[model samples]
Structures are given as C-alpha cells and as structure tokens.
Target: MNLIKTAFCLIILICSSIPVWSQTTGKIVDTDRQPVEGATVVMQLPDSTYLGAAISAADGTFSLEPMADRYLLIVQHLFYQSQVVKGQTRDAGIIVLEPKEHSLAEVVVEGERPLVTVEQGKLSYDISAISKKHIVNNAYEAICKLPGVQDRSGKLSLIGAKDVTVILNGKASTLTQEQLIEMLKNTSASQVQTAEVMYNTPPEYHVRGAAINIVTAKAADNTLQSELSATYSNQYFGSYSGNVNFLLTKGKSSLNVSYNPGYSHIMTVMDLASMHQYDGQVYDITQRQKINTKGWKHNIYAEYGYQINEDNALSVGYNGALSGNGKGTIDVNGNFQNSHNDKVQDSWLHNVFARYSSGFGLDLGVDYTDYSMNDYNHLESELTGHTRQLLDYTSDQKIRKVSVYADQSHSLANDWTLKYGVRYDYTDNRNSQLFNQTEGKDNVDNSSSRLYEQIANLYAGFDKEFANGLYLSLSATGEYYSIGNYHKWSLYPQASLSYSPSEKHTFMLGVSSEKEYPTYWDMQTSTTYMNAYEEIQTIEGLRPANVYSVNANYLFLQKYMLSLFYERIDDYFTMEMYQAKDRLALVYRTQNWNYYQSFGMSANIPFSIGNWLSSQVNATVVNDRNRCDHFWDIPFDRNKWACMLSMQNHFSVGSQLGFDLDAMYRSSMISGISDTKPVFMVNVGAQWNFLKDKASLSLNCSDLFDTMRMKVKNRYAGQHIDLNMGQYSRTVSVKLVYRFGGSITKEKREVDSSRFGH
Candidate 1:
C-alpha cells in the first residue's frame, strides 16, 4: 500500500508540474516554398532532453511553447531531408526543408538495420530492410518480429492495448481475425513495405483503440509478377498449405489476386469439473472428453485499382473464405456425443477517393457481406444403466450485412483541421435449431432478427508547439448513433501534452474517451448447447461500454519507452457462468458489470549484444478490478494483478541468413469469475535466401518447450467451474517461397486499405 501511494503521488506531481509559457509559432515549407503538411518539428534543450514536438498543418504552420527562449529545433519528414536549427526568437519565421529525390543512390545504408522508428508517437517498421538479414515466410511472421508485438494462440496483440484492429493501407480489414491471419500468412514479406502502429486512434479511422496498418509497395515494372509458396507443419498431426499471388500493372491501372488453400488434422482433449447449487440442493459433476478433427480451409482475394489522376482514384475488391469437414467426439460421465461443423463467408467492396491541392479530401465507399454456418450433433446417454437414450441436434445460422460510408476532411487557417463522416450499416441474421429424441416429440427453435445502425461524426483538432519545449494537440469528436431502437449522441474528447526537456528524453500525457458495442452473438437470445452438461443463453438489451482512459509515456533516445496507463469502464458487458434452476446445467450469459477499472505499466527496451546479435525485451504489469454486485445478485468483486514478459532475439550471420529466438510468459489474472492460469512459450526460427533473393526457405519450431496451455477456474454465487482446454502447440514448420518478376524495384505506393472492406 505504501508503494502504491508513493507511485500515485509521483505521478500526480509530474502532471502538476507542467509549465505554461507563451506560444512560439513558425511555418514549414519545402525548398520551393510550398506548404508541407505532416512534417515533424521537435524541440530539444542543449543537453538533448526532449521538450516538445509538433506536426506542421496544411498551411505548413506550427507553434511551440518552451520555458526558455533559446532551444534547438529538428524538422523531419519522409519526403524531405532532416534539418536542424538553433534559435532564440519566439517566432522562428519560415523554415524550408529540402526535398528528397526518390533515388536508390541517395539512400543511406547502415551497418545495423533499425527494427523500429518512432515518429509523431507512431511506430513503423521497415520490412524490406529487416528481410535482408532474416527469413520471413509471410507478413504475419514479419509482424511477430516487430517490437512489442505478441502472438497468443495465433492472435496478434500489442502491449498495453485491450484490443487491436488491423487495417490494410488505411482501411479496416474486411476479413475476420482468422481470415486475416491466414491472409497474412499467405502474403510474402517482399510485398509489404512497412507496418505502422498507432496507439491513439485518428479521426479518419472510425474504430477506436490501437491499430496496425500494412503498407505495400507498387510494382515498378509495367508487367506481370507472380509468387508461389508451400508450407508443411507438424503438431500432433500434419498440416499442409499452399498459396499463389499475382500482380499486374499497366499504365495507370493495376490488379492483385491471391488464393490460398490449407488442410489440417488436429487432436484435442478437455477436462471440466462443475458444482452447481439449486433448490436447496447441490450437484457435483466431472467430465473428460477427447476429440479429433480433420478440415480444409480456402481463402481467395482480388483487388483492382485505377488512378484517374495524381489525386483521384477508384478501387474495388473481393475477399472470400470457406472451411468445412470438422468432426469431434466428447464423453461426459460415460455419455458420448459426436459433432461436426462447417462455415462459409464472402465480402465485396468499392471505393472512390479524391484529393485537391487546396487541402480538401473526400472518400466514399460501400460494401456487402454474407456468412453462414452449420453444426450437427448426436448424443447417447444411459442414466439407469439399463436403457440407452439417443438425442439428435442440428443448428443453422446465416448473416447478411450492407455498409456505406462517406468521409471528408478540410484544412483551415492557423494550422487547424476538421474531419467529418457518416456511416450506415444494416444486418439481417437468422438462426434455427432442431432437437429430436427417440422417445419424445421433436423440438424446433428459430429466430430472425434485423438491425440497422447509422452514425455521424465530426472532429476538429489543432497541433501547436510552444516555448519551453511544450507541444499540445486538442481534439474532440461528437457522434450521433442510431442502432435498432436505441439512439444517442456522445462526445469523445482528446487532449495531449508533450515536452522534451532534453535531446534524449521526452514525456507525454494524454486522455481520451471511446465506446465499444456488443457483438451480434452477445445480443442473441437463443440457447446454445456445449455438449450435454453445459448450455448458453444470451439476453438482449445489453448496452455499449464506455471507456475513459489516461496515459503517460516517456521515451529515451527513441529506443526505450515506458508507459503508464489507466482506464475506467462503465456498464461493461461480458460473459459469466450462471445456474438458475435445480438439477439443471450451468448457462453462460452476457450481463452488465457495474464498472471496471485497470491500471498498468509497460516498458520496451531494445539493445544489441555483440556485433551480430540484437534483442528487444518488453514487460507489462497490470491491476484489474471489477465491481458489480447488483447484476450478479450477490456480493462479488474482483481484484487481481497480472504480469507479462516477452523477448525477441535476432542473430545475423550475414545479409543472406538470419536466426531468431523468441519467448513469452504471462501470469494468471481474473476475468469476471474466471481465474486464468499462467502460460509460457518459446520459439526458434531461421531463414536463408538464395537465387539472388528470388528463392527463400524458412524453418521454425513453435512452442519448443511445450509449455503453452489455457486453464481457468470460476466460482461465483452457487456455481463453481474448472476447465483445462487443449491447444495446438509444439509445431515444427518449413516453408519455401519463390518469386518471378522482371525489373523489380521497391516503389512507394499510397493506397488506403479502407478502399475495400465488408
């Protein structure tokens, strides 16, 4: 308790010590005197302590507040050469940055490649530079090598972030999580130029929270290029995958297509124990199940683009996936159940965008998606030990949705910007289930629901640099949302203050608000069964969760970062196990929690060991608390502290060969009633490039120590449950990729992923 109090007091003191000074403003321009938007201006003291930083607005104007009159300023941009100037004037006047010629000869070659770079609070990794020394099979593999990125059971997450969204270029991904992972696995690293990480959600992106955008380079030659790859992996079973991608360019038009297919066989086991109380009675049940599944999955994507001019373009894309042939068996207290499942999804999108030299931008897009799934099960039970009871169940579900949106941005005088957008989405969902008993009448359950949502948002923001190395940005968004029968208007405000007291040190504080809505399944009122002992029934009318967050960040020499964050959630909705009747199974439902609170600290450190080895280490500690006695019908509050650590090491033998070692560990934490168990994993991989970079081979062993697993314990009210789930761990994989093209060169391309999504 004393330590916590001391830390709290220190934070308060730091925040309260921020000094206010007179504002200093200046304009940034290119060599030709044209206003340069997005150029970064950083102010630093003589000792290299960071004071503050700002980005030039559309009018190439920036303002800074520094306590001292004299300071050093550094200006940088991708298209311009970096510049430094020392000044003591409150107004530095016009500053010009020399334009950089995009030629290979002018590129600077460093002995050791930088894995990550921080600019304007965003982290970006250069894939091309990293791939020169490491073997990367796909975009996903490259992403795993990035600092502070974690892969948990095939899902990628960032440190200090509750949820993450992936965007292609600047658009939200149209594919689901599984589909996105598969797509990334099939895409070669050579096709991706850079991956940018944004912790603070920008106004242009409708979604809130952290996001990662993968940017791809355009084909330099006016010809066709293609790639083919094959991979094989062994877990408890064998899996095989293959992919083919093609890129074609002619004049101002281009087309890209990719297809991937995979087959896998898996074995799993589960043990569950439950204690339920109802009607003044208690029941204890134990069950063990073993299952085997064999399946195949396919992904197909195609995109077309036409550049009407330098500032106008049109894009269309189609993405689809299908998976089926799944079978499993379960035994519950000597009772047996068999099940099978299949799924299919398809999506299409079209977009048009235009930009003008007068700082005006417009984007319009529309998308449609359809998805369906089917599951069949059969059960046999013998309660009396004399008679055999047979039950058959089948369920079918389908969803169709349409979305349309338009957004525009306009630049104002005095380095201010305004963005506004409107979006419409409509979804129709249908679910049906049939239950049959040999000695009883058949029962059927069916439900059909439709939802229509409309949203309008407006945001205005400004970035100003001040004297005494202080920089600030203030922005707020007002959104009107109409979903089904619920309509409301909300304001999401944002404020940030940063100071660079010296050249190598920087401090920043930010506050923001956002909201999250319940998923379609979370709002469903249908009963779903998990084997014979458990069932789930979710109720409707769940409200969206509102979150207010505060964060403080410190960066040292652009290589080390430490962050402290806190968030408070109101009306949080999540799943919990409940038992309502006597002699009945436990049912899982989504209920509103009164409130949720969390505080966490994270650190990222990157260093080099010797001349050939480099490593990055990241650690985070968090305290989670929840209070919701009223909704649970009992006094239940949760508080727990969790910690996670991840380390990545890269060993380079030369430019053509590289090896990697990675390990991750996470401590248990409480989520609702479940107390999760600890998990740890280690991985090793190596890559070799031959045939003048046209052919590449990679070998990897995942979960080398076989210490990765999921276990959870839940106890609340009159229900107690323990579960240990299976995992696809300890996998050894090998991949070979080949590229064929003519006159290939990396050319930067500006493409917004939002152009296609559903």
Candidate 2:
C-alpha cells in the first residue's frame, strides 16, 4: 500500500508542474451568415512555427491553447478563401469567408490540393480530393485507397500495426467487424469529410489501441436526404444485395435510418492427404471434400439526436442483424472413406445504446448487446474394413453483454490537456451440445457449460505541444479481469512523440501495450465432426495473451511513407492439427504457445502520369519466430521470412469515365508446424457517371486469373499432412446507384459484440 501511495503522489506532482497557456476562441461563417462546419483552424507564431490546431464544430465554434501571448490564427475551408488574423488572449468574433467562383470541372483540375497532411498525432486524408481523382462510391472503398492500409479478403488492417478499431465522428463504435463493414458499404462517399489514422490512440477516445476515425459532414438545418443502390455478382452462382438510407434534420432534432438486405450462394472445395503412424501401424489416406451453402441476411439501423442547448446534447440508437434458413451440404470422397453431411443454422443480434455529453467536457454512455445462434448437423459415412457409421447433433449458444463509461477532460494553464476515464463491462454466456444418435466408436460426449466475466478499467493521460514543432502524449490504464476462478490485474502504458519541422518532412515514434482475449466458443469443451476421419475440439484453461509493440514512421513529400515495426506476444494461441496416437483419427484444436515475436519494415510509394493515370505501390518484408516448450508431446521452435507486394492504378478519361486495376502477391509463410505456398491475384473495375452527375454504373471483376488458392504442408516428429483449399474467389459484379435529395449525413453508435458469437 505504501508503494501505491507513492506512485499516486508522483503522478499528481508531474501533472501540477506542467506549464499552462491562455485559451483562444473563435467562430467562422460564410458570406450569407450561415455557419461553416468542418473548417480547419490553426494557431502559429509570426515566423510560421506550428502551435496547435482544431476543427470547427456544427455551431462554427472552436477553441485552442496558445502558449505564447501573441500568435497568428489561420482558417481554411474546402470551397472558401483562406483567412488569417492576429490575436492575443481574445475571441475573434464572426469571421466571414467568400465563396470561390469555380465550376465543378475546374475544381477537379486544380492540382494544388494536397491528398494527405500530418497533424499533431495523426495522418489526415482529404476524402474530397481523393474522390475527384478516383471512382470512389462508398466509405469502404475510400478507406481502401488510403496509403499503408491493406484489404485482406474483406477485412481492413494497417500495414505495420496490430488490431485496428474504427470510430465515427470521434465516438467509439460498438458494432462487430462484419456489421461495421456492412454499414460502411452502404454509406455514400460524399458525406465523408476526412479520415484520421492514429498509431497510439489518446485516452479521450475510450479505446486502448490504434484507431481510424471517420469524420462526416454535418447536415444543414431543416433538410431531408435519401439514397438507393443495388448490386449483383456472379461467381459460379448468383448473389444480390441492396440498401436504402434516409436522413432528416429539423429545428434541434435529427433522425437517421438505414436498411440493407443480401442473399448469396457459395461453394468451396478442399483436398487432404495424410500419413498416419499410430500403434506401430502406418496408414496413408487421401480425401476430396466439397461444400455448398445458401443464406439470407438483413441489417437495420435507426438513430435520433436532440440538441438541448449550445453545451448539451443527447442521442439514442438501435442496430439489429437477422439471418435464418441458412442451409449447407458437404460431400466427401476418399480412397478409404466416403461421407455426406447436411447442416442448418440461424442467428440473431441486437444492440441498443445511449449517450449524453455536456459543454464542460463530460461524456457519459451506456450500451447493451444480445446475441444467439442455433445449429443442427447430421452425418453418414462408410470406412474401409468397417461398418457404416452415423452421427447427429444439435448445438445452441446465447450471450448478453452490458457496458458503461464516463470520461472527463480539463484544460490547464499553459498548454497542457489532461483527460481521464473509467469503464465497466459484464458478460454472460451459455452453451449446450446434445447428441441424438451415435453408431460408431466415439470419444465425445454431450456437454453444457456457463461462463460469467467482468472487467473494470481506469485510465488517465496528458498531451503537450512544444514551441519547436514537437508534440508528445502519454497515458496509462489499469485493468482488472475476472472469469470463473481466474482473477488478474494488469497495467498498460502508451506514449507517442511526433515532430513536423516543415511541410515536406514528418517523423513519429510510438510504444504501446495491450491484452487480447480469445473467443468464447474456443474455450468451451465440445466436439464437431466434419467427416468420419476428421473432427474439431475445444479445450479448457485457455488464457489471454499480453502484447507489446513499438513502431516508427517517416513521411516525405506528403505522398510517400516508410515504417518500421517490432512486436512480441506472451502466451500466444492458435489452431493446429495433430494425429491421434491410439487411433486413425485426425484432430484440430487451439493450443497455447510460450511466445511469438516479429520485426518488419514497409514502404508506400505513390505517383501519377500527367492527369490521365494515378498509381500507388506498397511493399513489406517481415521475419517471424515462434516457440513452445510443451505443445502436446512434440515441442519445437520455428522461424521464417516473408514478403508482400501490391499496386493500384486508376485511369480517368475526362470527368465521367474512369478505370481501375489492382494486383497483389504474397510470398510463402510459416505458422506453427505448417508452411503455406505463395499467392497472387489481380482485379479490374470501371465506372461511368450520367444524368447530371446524379446516377452512376460500375463494373468489377476480381481474381481474374483464379490464382488465390492456398496449399499447406505440415511435417513434424510423427505428423505429415498436405492440404489444398480452394474457393469461389473469381467473381464479376455490377452496381447501380441513384441519388436525389438534400445533402446527406449519418451519425452511428454501436455495441461491442465481437466476443458474443461463434
């Protein structure tokens, strides 16, 4: 207890000793007396040394801390003339900017606008500038075009970072990854103002890792907006998806609604060859498996916001996802075994949230989520020198979660900003598996399990800016986790420093620590059969991992970026295949590793050829090592080197026609006891606009050469396996979009349900 008291006193002393500065306040408006939102406001010295920056809110009000008694204030907007003023501890009241007299065609040809800018602790991308040069249709597509961001399958991640959390309008989102991706797909690109990427997130964001914040344009008073779009794709089968969105603002109240529906049919095939040596016998087995599935999905969202006064606001929202009648069939053919299986699944997810914010830097929020899933499976198989076998089972899972948080920020004397927050989360999960028929020798049994978890977190941080164009931020979080009989307390500390001496060069360094928990389904004791010879099982006593990471980045010319990163994780876990020692069965399970480490470097280079073509290239090289001293009965240590390359090109003919070509390649890599082969893929797309820029048609083709198949080989003390996995990777898609309404904007809030489902 004495040590704790000493640490607390040290923190208080450090915070009180920092210097303070005076506050600068201002407002911006257009020539028509209408407020201008999303304007950039900056404070600097007479010699052009950067001090601080902020964005104008919906009411055209902004505040900044200026360490010096005298400074210059600069205001800039997209469609208006820049304005500058000299001030000292005073408010600049009602500054007006004149609209530029330029046509849309002329605006597209202006080459002076920069695509990206380096701010205090983030990299900001101008979405409007990028849209003018590319054929971007939605928020998801625009994010894919950002430098150093990679799109693997349908998921997005930074090139040299760990997990990424996406937020909207500076608010944390609680939706699952799949739900968030769908929402971004349905959102129109015109509503986005800027995208900010942060390597080490600040404490005010209420998140603990790297993040991407999407800032949307604010709506005009007393306006209504709506949009409709449809898509069709063919990849050995037909699929359809459509969305509708509406927004309304009147007086002090705003309402937003959106709906999306989709239907798909998919097919995949895999081949496996295994050499099993058990009980002094060696058996060679080969099998081919095919799976066909069809499903229907629907998503709905609604939100309402009320502004009680200039300094207070309230918002409430609901989001839901429903899918049912999903059916699948599997067929297997092998030299020693033959099997057929049928399965059906249904699921539902619901989330509700509310938030309240005050002008005095106080924010309070609450969220709740409920999720459920049901599955049924039946299998029939025949084995060589054995009788026919049958197996049937049903599984059900349910989860409920609740979260509450409060945050506060204070502006101190000089130029110090202090922030602190506290949050609590509780989760309850129930799972059951029942067997109806069993005809063959079985090692699995009917099981039921219930789990309860709780987490409490408290964090505080400070930010400071120096007169030499340098910025620094530091934060620390204490967390307590309780699950069943496991209880532990951990501390996570983060720090970042950035320097921008000039417009042509910027450098940043960051260090962070976090903890990652496994999925709920992976911890339950259960067995699932895929065929007569293969099965999957879940184990007990799985623990979360602790991750520590460091990264450094350099930007030159505002278009090229270089990054170096290193990371180490303790108690890492992943899935691996093992040969049963007493039988001719193969098992797949998730197990823990002692440690994992990696070091990597990446580069992003962008260029253009006149006004007709623009292109970007990305390359990364990484070395990974894994160690385990007690993995099953065979322990080993492995290391390997891997590399990746990708390029994206865009071609524009005039202002209404555009084309896009992209390609990616990945070298061979190793994971645990497996070695994967190389992969390559190419994609093409085209877009055309008509009807006074209100209608658009687009065509896209992916994996043109069908070269995305994956092959793996695993060889160890007594395990030998070769697997080939192929899916419907090649597809042709066409989309149509039409817009007719007032300017559109959307505000979204979500509940975290990532750990609620299988």
Best by lDDT: 2
Could you list the CA RMSD of all candidates, in the order they appear? 15.2, 11.4
lDDT agreement with native, every candidate: 0.68, 0.81
- lDDT tens per residue, model 1, 606-704: 888675887788999999998787655565688999999988888988657889888899999888867889998889999887775567888999899
The TM-score of candidate 1 is: 0.77
Model 2: residue 93 alpha-carbon error in angstroms:
28
Per-residue error for 455 in candidate 2, Å, reads 1.0
